[model samples]
Target: MHRSKGIVIGFWVVTALLCLQMGFTAYAQLSMPEVAEAIAQLGFPHYFRKELAWAKLLGVVLLLAPVPARLKEWAYAGFAYTLVSALIAHLAMGHGPESWIYAVVTGVLWGLSYFFWRRLQAPSVGLRPATA
Candidate 1:
């Protein structure tokens, strides 16, 4: 039981950090002129930023709300894809580590959140201690 509690704590903490990163980036996409310029420079249409921001907001809602497991799974997959795409785009554009470092760090956070979430879902899986 104590282990389960610890896992729960770890899950929420990591998930919260992931959500904060996504939320901040989404806000940046929506309001930051530099972000707009960067995307446009990358050949994205002007409307992409707003559309991505709304999608991220919806993803955040699904992640935080007590929605169905299927919805949460979709949110997780969306975030994973978003992070990977951002990293790839930054690299492909010849941007240095400064540009893509946050995505790498957040990717780790996302991995942790997914790990703990799966553990929580099947707490009786192989992680459980054998009783005396």
Candidate 2:
């Protein structure tokens, strides 16, 4: 089935935004001492900051590359899990909205990206909200 132009555009835009946010955060975590201190303050080990940053970079690559559908799905799921976990960590640490708001905004971007992705996949036998 041919994909709809609108859906294709929507997928790219939202996915780009999501990837950008993740990628920027990963960069910050890797390069900024402040980020490391913040992560430590949140009760996460120092190593976790590196691990999470690398994982985010990997997930961003997977989402942007023309990988298998299963891999793409896994990347999306990983991002969703990361966002939720971040929110929980912030809340558990009693951080104010400024600290946790990143997760909330990223989650919205993630949702839009996933939604458009699903619509792009709606071309199979049972899918309906897909392309033209």
Candidate 3:
């Protein structure tokens, strides 16, 4: 398979994984009072969880859409931001090994999304003149 195709495939795989993770996180937030209690136990701001959940849902939509490159770029940016914040929150709270594992997974997913976003932004063969 072509390298671009491979990148796209990787993008989708990462996207799916993120969607699963974030979707479940959102579900837990929405349905599981225990999750809220847990978040409260961490002593972090509440907005982080709510906003992260929404951002994840929106990011998934952008990845799935056939929109312009700029929007896709923004989508990846959102993913990166969310994941990084999650990593930070986990670290600051002194969670055990699972925290590091989650950070690594989020980093890998962000890297994959970043790779594809950059690829999409590259100038196409038959496209318009390059911007200066």
Candidate 4:
């Protein structure tokens, strides 16, 4: 079955958004004192800035790659998990609402993308196609 145009657009949008978020998070690690303070407060001193940068970059690549459908689904699942984790981190660390904005958007975008993907899947042979 062909992918829906909406899903394709959503996939690109999510990829770009993830990249933008990665850039902002990476930059915050250097430019914002709050990032370091938050990290410290979270008690993960060894989890340096580079780790998050690399993870986000890798996640973006995985989501954008021309992998098998199953692999793509797995990538989306991973990305969703990461978004939720980031949201929790921000809330637990007392970061502003802005810090969790990406997480919220990512979650919504992923949900929409996944919904379209599922809707586009071919129906089983045992079932009759829906009549218009």
User: Which candidate ranks first by lDDT, i.e. highest?
Assistant: 2
- Candidate 1 vs candidate 4: the TM-score winner is 1
lDDT measured at residue 47 in model 3 versus the true structure, 0 to 100: 72
- What is the C-alpha local distance difference test score of candidate 1? 0.89
Error (Å) of candidate 2 at residue 36 is: 0.3
Residue 109 CA displacement from its true place in model 4, Å: 2.5
What is the TM-score (0 to 1) of candidate 4?
0.64
Best first by TM-score, ranked? 2, 1, 3, 4
TM-score of each model, in listed order: 0.89, 0.91, 0.74, 0.64
Q: Residues 6-123, candidate 1: write the lDDT tens digits.
A: 8989999999998999999899999999999998877779999899888888988998899998999999999899889889989989999999999899999989999998787764
Q: After the best TM-score superposition of candidate 1, give how far the Cα of residue 3 lies from its true spot, in angstroms.
A: 6.7
Better of 1 and 3 by lDDT: 1
Local accuracy of candidate 4 as per-residue lDDT tens digits, 8-52: 676566656665665576677766787777667766664665576
Q: Tens digit of lDDT per residue, candidate 3, span 28-83?
A: 76667787776776676777567656776777777778888788778877777766
Where in model 3 is the C-alpha error above 4 Å?
Answer: 1-3, 124-132
Candidate 1 ranges with C-alpha deviation above 4 Å: 1-3, 123-132
What's each prediction's clash count? 0, 0, 0, 0
92: Cα error in model 3, Å: 1.5
Whole-model Cα lDDT of every candidate shown, in order: 0.89, 0.93, 0.71, 0.68
